[model samples]
Target: MASSLTKDSSGIPGSEKTFFGHPRGLATLFMTEMWERFSFYGMRALLPLYLVSGGTAAAGGSQGGGLAMTAATATAIYSIYLAMVYLLAMPGGWFGDRVWGPRRTVAISASVIMLGHLTLALPGQGAFFAGLALVALGSGLLKANISTMVGHLYDGPDDPRRDGGFTVFYMGINLGAFAAPLVIGTVGQQVGWHLGFALAAVGMGLGLVQFLYGTRHLNPRSGLVPEPLTREERNRVLRRTVLVVLAAAVFYGVVVVAGLYTMNWALVPITVAGLLIPVAVLVRIKRDRELSDGEQSRMTGYIWFFAAAAVFWMIYDQGGSTLAIFAADKTDTSVFGWSFPASWFQSVNPVLIMALAPLLAWIWLYLARRAKEPSTVVKFAAGLALVGLSFFLFILPLSAAGGGKVGPLWLVGIYLLQTVGELCLSPVGLSVTTKMAPAKYASQMLGVWFLAVTAGDCVTGLLSLAGVDLNTTGVVALEAAVAALAGIGVYAYRGKVRTLMGRVH
Candidate 1:
């Protein structure tokens, strides 16, 4: 199976390469990611408004979607959804590594996500909530494993095209992110949110078909079936599954009680318990010998990077939450005598990502040549700092609004800065996983990385509760706290992180 999944470091699961400058396998994965992201972000762009829009107020609190939810409620729901998706990525990663492999996992996930989108597009309340759940689970699975398959594209540790391939791969993700909001969000605003959900369903369907069609080029190294497990391996898998299920239960409870949409405050205890289990796992890993010395060190560094980056994400992903609402509710969007819908502003970040990704790739390449390239830790800190700067940009127009509308250009500017910060941090973090993680534990570590983003997203939900009428000082204060906390964490962990990184070429 491994031999069949292997490619000549250019194509997909079972094929050879050609003159297109990339493996044939990468093409399908590329479209798969693109459409997956399109489905995810397309729904994402409209979710805040759907929750806050007047037609659906009963399920939401007086401050949330069905009601005239304060911007904070919308932000809270957005952040929660984002967090859950990332958190589920852990299970998704494990399922791929232990059971399905990346290809099947991605395929199944895409199908599931399509179903979720269909549910969201249905004509009633119960379907919408249920659809959201399917979407979260599907995304968690796909987001974790798709990149794992990409890593499989390279046969060994020293493939030169791996970095470039990842860059191109991430570009696919951004391309989807870029297009989904414009297409789906605009349609949602025009026809109804249901239309946007339907579009997302179509997008996921497209991604699924693309994946099925391109199986010939898949990397031959995928779908590694484990031999029948011994007692220890079997026990370990069983234990981990139990822990994961328990943790997910708890976290869902907390998120539900806190969210206006899935108002299930009844689960707070479960959420608290869920939050603690992962920390306990880390503690066990620190004292356990299941990992090699190198594995131990890498896992330790991952924990910090995961946590620190989560802080960055909490602040960074606000683009979809607080910032989305801000654009919708308060931004002055008229242009050429046509007032632009706030949903359109979601396009700004992807555009900036498209623009900045190349420069970041070049900057890293230039630095690598000069032997002056920053370590992953350094780059991550810079990401945190850059996102911090982006948040400050909001203060100016937010303050100037003074209970009046702020110009949409200001929101555009903020997204540009945020997109640059994401370019610096988000995709690079994916690269860091492949670089630092040992093959034996790669998928697990990827899961950890995603979990961190999920944790940060959870915090974003809680923090979004801080205010709806956020003024310039309030926005500044919020951002400053995030920046300072992230900066301090990064600095304190600097030495350990470098030591774990070893000498990279």
Candidate 2:
């Protein structure tokens, strides 16, 4: 798998691939990632709380409250946005391959995101929804491209320092994620929504500037022009067939949007048709096998991680949903005679992620010296267990408080625990897939990686629909089931998974 890489003529990343007392360009990428993450998480932190409630009371919500959206719609909308963000990686990847290279894509996408945030800062109803669509589109381009750049920073898939590099990069992401809620959420909640969203816009603008300044450290385009199509490649039947399929998709989307279709209509038909349509087309290609052997192996790994990732996200991503609402209504947010806003509780996870990622990396390094470090499956299993335990931990305080007001510490403790679990699993998954996937299907495997996230989030959407006014027993049970299922899958794939990963060095 590593053999496919070709070094730049200068032959860097030689025996010693170090720069600025670290792996080459690590800090450059770090700052770039930091601003990018700040924009992303800042936007995300505001989304659920904003949508479910609207703006803070200081902004435009009821009595300094938020928009007051139903939990079901908020959760559904969140899931759809996240799902679309990842799914659009397909188009993002293609664009990176075709028109704008990764650097240009990153800059342009971030700029679009900046515009979206600016739009949100405006008061017009049309601008409000349009801003959201813009954010989704912009995120679609940026999310995948930034990660691809991380991969581009290295030459070979199996670079020994790859894990550490991703960990470092992961820290950049969480740093942004950490600051967003605290900074923007605080302003919106304390000041007003317009001011808060404007802060988010500024954050994204910072990212764009950082990306542009750091472009020189980046790799140039690969110049992979698509090969010309021949007679069979230009088949009229296939073109017409694709057109028909698209038209059908458009019609289906309109029905679903209009509420003429059933609730699960989007989920069921999309899942079924999406799965079948691919296999049907791929069946023809399977004969010629454009996919390499490594591609096949990488594809296999992608599915397992994707499934596992889905479950992980279903539980972790709830910080903004079930947990956020819990903080607002139920927690004793008072500290030193001052009451804090509820959405601030969401800040704990990103904070913890940034703090723990390096600690976990160091701990793993220490363990590796004695051969005590866990494998990826083991790490993933531990993550699932931590999540399960976190929920279990919450049961105590929640029940004790009678689901009423409790100390902010309780929420902080839970988010901290959740962040530890995230550090154990989330960052490494990127490097793992990058190393495992075949060269030909790299981006697609990444897309498939997103599917796991989509599935997990889809489940979250369903679970989030359950009324929290109830015991939340349903949500807890659902997460537990998901955790167990993910754990079992990890165990089943342990051997082959390890082999595909090769030695972690």
Candidate 3:
């Protein structure tokens, strides 16, 4: 049986070669992730604009096409939704490691995600929030497992193809992300909101179909448990799960009965959990006696990398929130006598990523052969600084426009800088996380990696509560300084971090 196959073996038994000289399974995983991202980014592109469109509030809703939420409320919901998506990845990874395995978990979660999008296609505010919750749950479950499956495709830790493979995979992500806004955004903004949501549902359905069909190409190990729980452990987990569910039900009933159910009230616990989970995970890893002293040391350095990533995403993710708002309200939509949808601007970063990722991948490979490749720490520092610079550059157009609409090229330039920064950090971080992970906690470690994003997104949501316009000069300046300072700090201490990392790089 394929489940008995060795993890190091590539794909489809003897027919291992295909898909750009990589494993055939990569093509399958690639397309699956592509369609999933199409659904994800499609909804993201439309969400902010839809929230404020009609200027009505169901709980707070739109005109004919939106929920009509205030800008602050919509931004908070967007950030919270993003946070929850990554936040649930922790348990998702645990389930993959101990219960269902990555392949099964991915399949199950993808089905749930399709349902979420479909729910969003339904009319009414209740359906909207329900759909977001469903998507968050399913996406969180699907994301870490799928990426872990990709890592499983390579031979081992030292395989030269691992980083390159991840880069190719990252490109698939951008290909989907690039197209989503153009298609989904246009429809959502111009047609009906629910129709745009239905398109997202179709994309996810397509992804699931292809994923199921292509499972044969994947390693059989993907379907087998890496660390199955003992009977005693399983019983304990079941009891705890039941208790948690009951508690949640009780809380929901109490809130509904008391007439105290508000969206912000619901967000509070989620926000708190997002802030706490990464720290809890780190503490758990630190306390684990199974790891060697060297492994523990590497984790110390990983903390620094984690912090840098959180800061990067805190700013970078604004492309769909604050920056999207800026594009809609303050940027000139006309180019060459044509006015475009503001959501179309969201496509800029992915398009840049699609164009540049291959070039960066080749450059990294070239540098590695010559022993001149930058350390992961160096790359991270560069990424932080570049993102900071992107925000800082926004000051120029802000000054020139004097509160009037700026040309679209200004956004293009900003996205260009941010895209390069993402290349420096994101794919590199994924590869490094896989390499540095302790064997017993492989999938869980990836979950922890996603927690960086969760932390950043949670902070983004909290910032909305401060009532600061994210597009203002003061806000932009502060953001730029923080990232720049972090980059400088990381660069200054790279030597020490390298020592902690030992030989991993």
Candidate 4:
């Protein structure tokens, strides 16, 4: 069995040959995640626009191709969908750790995600909702495990290439993200929404195929469950898994039957789950007798980082919801007399990340060599502050436009700032989680880290419900002010957080 394979006496597998000075497995994981991100972001770019579009045949008319939802409703749905995607990571990671292992879990996830996109290409609201559910579930399974696998590629905590490898892997994510909006967004907006969705399905199919073909290159350890269950325990777990799935199905059915399948009703439960799960996980970690005091303190620091991350994402993720609407309705898409699709704006951040990732990776390594690297908490503070400033930047263009369409450059500038923020915080967050989490619950703790994103998405949903117009100056300023305050608050506590982190930074 591949899972039983081990390194030769030289401590290297035949397939462990270097790629860009890292293991060959990095290339495989990189391309796999790239395609997955392409599929995910491609589909997402179309969602808000599609929801509000009318299913009419009028060119550029809002009346012919969408569900005809209001901006608030559509934004709310988008936020909830994103929230669920991260929220389910908890169980998905647990399943990988306790049952399927990362390799199998990732494969299953890609397959389901592909199927979900295909289903969305079909007609009817029923298909739409079902497809969203499947995609969310699949994303939950894939997201944390892939990152965990990247960490597994390194032999030890002290591996010098670990951070660089993650940065490279993150670039793959952006590569896919960069292409999705250009390709899928154009197809969905101009060719037809269904065709765009079909393209996304194709992207996932390619990813799964590539991953299956390249599995041999990965470390064999990645394929085995961390702690396999006993035969009796496996049977019990199987039964419980079935029951949980069935119960979820019944709940959705009841919601539909009760005519409560709207955004407002859905937000209530999702928000509660998003907020409570991380808190519960933190409490569990604190009470675990197996952890040393140092580990506990590190976990406490992680929780603080998690809170700041949630705040950062609450502002950053508006790119798909509020920002998407703004691009479609308020921004000038014309450049050199050519009008671009609104969804293409979604590509900006990824494009920037792809361009900047290598530089940032080098910078971090350079700083480390000089013994001047910023602590993880400091990076978190910088990221939050940058994102807050990005929001503030929008105020300038909003004021200048004064109810007229603003130049696309304004959005470009905003994305540029936000990309810097993402670079500082996101990859760092993943690395820190792996370093700090207890060995027995590594993958689950990663899931807990992602719950910060879940919380952000839920909060975004509520914020969207306020119905703030992107073209309005007062609302834009208010958003900028609030984000700035949050960023400042996090930075102010950097000293205390650094103390908690101890030697992990």
Residue-wise lDDT of candidate 4 within 1-505, one digit each (tens)?
1221333223466643565667678778999999999999999999988887872211244436578777777877888899899889887887788889999999999999999999999978789988988999999999888888898888776787786788779889888999999999999998999899999999999999999998897889889999888999989988998999899899989999998787656666766777677778788888899998888888877888888888888889888877787788778898999988999999998888888877897899999999998878778888988888988887787677655778899999999999999999998998798788877776467777888888888877766666645336676667667667766776788898888888777
Instruction: Give candidate 2 regions above 4 Å deviation.
Output: 1-29, 54-65, 124-126, 150-168, 214-217, 222-302, 464-471, 492-505
List TM-scores for all candidates, in order: 0.83, 0.78, 0.90, 0.88
In model 1, where do residues sit more than 4 Å from their true spots? 1-19, 55-68, 220-262, 266-274, 290-302, 434-440, 464-472, 488-505
Q: Considering only N, C-alpha and C atoms within 3 Å, which residue pairs clash in candidate 3?
A: 54-63, 57-60, 57-61, 58-61, 61-67, 61-68, 62-66, 62-67, 62-68
lDDT of 3: 0.86
* Best model per TM-score: 3
Q: Regarding lDDT, does 2 or 3 come out ahead?
A: 3
Model 2: per-residue lDDT, tens digit, 1-505?
Answer: 1221233224453544343334345555677678766766776766766765643211222233445566555666666567667667766776766557767777788888899899988875567667877887888887777777776776667765565567668777777777777888888767777678888889888777766776666655322223333567558646987999999889888998887986456544433443343344333333437766655555555556656777787777777766776666567777899866666676677766666766887999999999998888888877777776677667766676663567888878777777887777776676576666666655565665665566666666654444343126555665666686677768777888766555431
C-alpha lDDT of residue 237 in model 3: 93
Lowest summed-lDDT stretch of 10 residues in model 2? 1-10
Model 4, residue 143: C-alpha shift (Å): 1.7
lDDT of 3 by residue, 40-118 (tens): 9999998888777776322112235577776777777888899899889888888898999999999999999999999
Weakest ten-residue segment in model 1 by summed lDDT: 56-65
- Candidate number with the higher TM-score (3 or 4): 3
Question: Considering lDDT, where higher is better, how would the candidates rank from best to worst?
Answer: 3, 4, 1, 2
lDDT per residue as tens, model 1, 1-505: 1133345444464465431455667778999999999999899988877877773321221122233455666666677777778778887877776777777888899999999999998866678778988999999988868887887877565777776777778789889998998899888876777878999999999999989988777876665643335579879988998999999788777767777534435223323433565566556656677767876777677776767677787777878877777676667767877865678888888888788777887899999999998777777777787777777778788778766777778887777776776776777687687677666665466666676666776665665554544324675667657775686678667887878766531
Report the number of the highest-lDDT candidate.
3
User: What CA RMSD would you report for each candidate?
Assistant: 5.7, 6.2, 4.5, 4.5
